[model samples]
Target: MTLVLKAMALTCLVLLLLQNAPGVGAQMYPDFKLQQPQSSVVVIKGDTLTLNCTLSGSGPVGAVKWVKGSGSDNQTVYEQKGSFPRVMRAVSAPSNDFTIRISNVSLEDAGTYYCVKFRKGIVDDVVFRKGGGTEVSVHARPSVPVVSGPSHRAVPGQSVPFTCSAKEFSPRDIKVKWLKNSTLVRAEPPHITPELSNSSYRMSSTVQVKLSEDDVRSELTCKVQHRTLAAPLRKTYALHQALRVPPSVSVVAAPSGAVEVNKTVNFTCRVQGFYPGAVTVSWLENGTVMNAGSSTQPTETSRGLFELNDTVTVQAGEEKSGSRFTCLVVHEDQEPISGTGILRVTAPALGENNEGLIGDSSDILLSSPGLWLGLLLDKALLAVILFFLFKRILP
Candidate 1:
């Protein structure tokens, strides 16, 4: 019975040794030292940042975890105690560098950040870190204002009204100024573009000035300043207007006939429809200005609407062919208007067996049988008369 008890004790010992063997054969874990992180504070609602953690000597880290410690239960930031919330990446070289990325940071995110590595249920290393902080200063985009003032280009003392405004982004106290050649112009009651964006933004500006062609031609600018934006804003436009003028020239053909060869015809051109109308009028034969043919007598229109003077009458023979006549008009602005009309000379007809005479001009008609019979009767009568004359003249 004692021998049986010894065998049972030996078996128990063997079982205990087998359980301890795996744990004892494990390699010794090398210790890691975490270098302290650089300290920094950031402004709120502003730039984003990343925290970098460095350490000395790398160990066989089963898992690297990130965590944030609070009073009660340590809140897990990137890793739970035994497992990694993320896979830890390491450089193949001997040095250790771990960087965490943070985006669009706010003030509340400020606190202690840590990076810890673990191996075989042993704590390898711990690193303390902090991301930059921010001071909350919220602002919005500024307003767009209207441009106004005297409607045209300003002269020396014309007091051209120049105006701009920002009605939208209000209560932000917008300031406006005028700029010329990139330099600010001093004037009473400056201007600016206000926050056109909703109340979320700040905006303001204004510009009122008296200017001229020189001022308008020079680069004109409206400057806006706001508390929120980093720099001033501006807008610009050219001052110009399109003006209208009166009517142009008039052309007419006289005697209104198709002039055949050797026929005489006439032409006339006068300045007609217009306002504060034409000051001078003349006709052009082809390109030659007909200044010699001026009529001093002015004829009033039957409608009596305007005074029509300077009738240019030209006597043209049929030899004048393919002649172009134009009436020229010069107005108050010395603005000139010209219009053209073509002259045509008729040509005579052409035919065979033709005579210079226009009547019965064909030889075929003169050679007809009826015409020959009439000619023979006349010849017979003339021959009888000649015989009678011989009879009388022989005695």
Candidate 2:
């Protein structure tokens, strides 16, 4: 009976202790959440970044810290109560609101960031919770792609070379392409270069093409794609009818036969073998320029080249003999080219069937000084002989 009574006493005490024991439940830490959902944030190298974090739940906030990177590389960049040289903290209106401002971001700042909260636990030493992470991306925009070479103007059956380049872009992945009349073209591999500091990369590419006559109306373009660009950057160049061969000048004199003195003569300068036909013809007499008469418009030849003619008329005279006449051709394709001819002015000679015929002496004597003297001496001798004959007949 005593044993039974002891057992009932022990059961009563055990029941009382069980009623006073605390209930088992999951451990709780301070409620932490990111005001802005974790997302990609792109900014220039010199721009500022702002990250906001919010706290909830009923508990005294032990501490707040911002961590950067992942795995073993994780590093605490900013602490609420700790001093960070680069982070600028703004005064929070509400005590639960935390804002972190970072100025002068660089390549090293590009990574994921997290806002972590630490709280002291009742039984456990300490507990922590992390808000959503913000992915930070710092970038440098590349300079506008430059397209050069291939000649602004080119001729058919020629090999044209071109280059496209972009400098100082962050993140080495960049797309460069070539197009002719909006059609894709196969080009050589791009040449990528890292900056001396190794923080930025530059890219360049080249292409060579054999042009055809049909390509004269086509347009070529270089297109570039990058992360910082909203649209692809493009540079366009064209190849049209252009000069291929140098200009050639030739001088011709009218009346292919013997030259006459004090008569009208025509000098023609013909320029040929040049394309894009912007040319000027000049006539030079004894190294001095003279006014020209007529110039024909440039006309295309069978070879797709240009040819033009200019004429100047002058009266042949004695002084013109042995004088140098030059036909100068000035063209866009090359320096001025010239052709020269010497003027040969001669007096008319006596005809085989001379029936007192002067044989165009009127035009001849005007320029020949020696011929005038000879004619005067002949007339004086004839008068003297006629006087002698008349005196003899009278005797």
List RMSD in Å for every model shown: 19.8, 12.1
Cα shift from native, residue 127, model 2 (Å): 8.6
lDDT of candidates 1 onward, in order = 0.52, 0.74
After TM-score superposition, the amount by which residue 36's alpha carbon in candidate 1 deviates from its true location, in angstroms, is 6.2
What does candidate 1's lDDT look like per residue over 113-193, in tens digits?
556554433233322222231222333335555555454323333544566655444235657777766778775654333
* Poorest lDDT segment (10 consecutive residues) of candidate 2: 23-32
Window of ten residues with lowest summed lDDT in model 1? 126-135
CA lDDT, candidate 1, residue 280: 68
lDDT string, candidate 2, 1-395, tens digits: 99999999999888644433432111232243435465778877777888777666654345777789656688988876667888965655456666788988777788898877655444432325566688987887788888877446555577878889998888888888899897899997788899887488899989886676555456778998888788998887664533145567888888654587887777788887776668878889999998875899999776566788888887889888887789888766456899876778888665734665565777767878999899899999999999999999995
Q: CA shift at 57, candidate 1, in angstroms?
A: 6.6
Candidate whose lDDT is highest: 2
lDDT computed for candidate 2: 0.74
